[model samples]
Target: MRYIISYVSTVNPDLSNTDIAKLMDHVNVHNNTIGLTGILIYSEGNFFQVLEGEEEIVKRMFERIKKDSRHYNIIKMLDKEMNDHSFSEYHSSFTVISDHYSQTELQEFLNKEKDYNPEHYKSILYLTQKFMKLL
Candidate 1:
């Protein structure tokens, strides 16, 4: 089965921007071999990411991510099986939300998830669509 998982995590203060870039590069390479696709957003020392792939593999990946020392306070925001891949365009696209979108827009965008849309994804989809075009 195909699955997608989204989570928000606190970035470890000790790591620099270069370290995060290197980590994402490593993740992208590993994700490619495993058939995963998604986007990662980092801003204000927090990471919001969506990963999609085979169920077991994605679960395992999330587990490994949970244990990675580079980030903490992992909070899963979405988990579901999907008929089609929503993020097939990239193996692991990275976006710094602050770079392309204003903090006000991002905050306003994030504050309005009272319910999920018909497709089961919520506000994250909107954020993904806007950022995906930038890459």
Candidate 2:
């Protein structure tokens, strides 16, 4: 069964843009290699990401992310089995939302858990879609 794991983390202040680019490249390569898919959302000082794939593979990837030094305060926001992958079209899409939204708005979305209303999930996916197009 496919599973979706959503998480939030705070990027370390010391992290450099080059480090982020290298990390993104590494994630893209690894996700493609393992047939995993997901979307990454970054706004303000937070990192929100949703990874979907086989349970074991997703879990392994999360474990590696937890050990990464570029981010801190890693928190799993959602993890559940899904009938389908919401982001099956992309190995991984990274989005930076800093246009007009406030940091609180971004945090509210990132703090959402699986128990949140279905409409909320749809909204999140919609925003991700919009951001994906921009990227």
Off by over 4 Å in 1: 89-135
**Candidate 1 on 33-93: residue-level lDDT in tens?**
7788766766567777878789998899999999999899998877877665655433333
Tens-digit lDDT track for model 2 on 1-135? 987787778889887767676766777787867888775665555576778889998898889889988889987756777666555423332346444333333344334433453645665555444444442
lDDT by candidate, in order shown: 0.66, 0.64
For model 2, name the residue pairs that clash: none
Position 13, candidate 1: lDDT: 100
Where does the lowest 10-residue lDDT sum fall in candidate 2?
101-110
User: What's the TM-score of every candidate structure?
Assistant: 0.71, 0.68
Give the number of the best model, judged by TM-score: 1
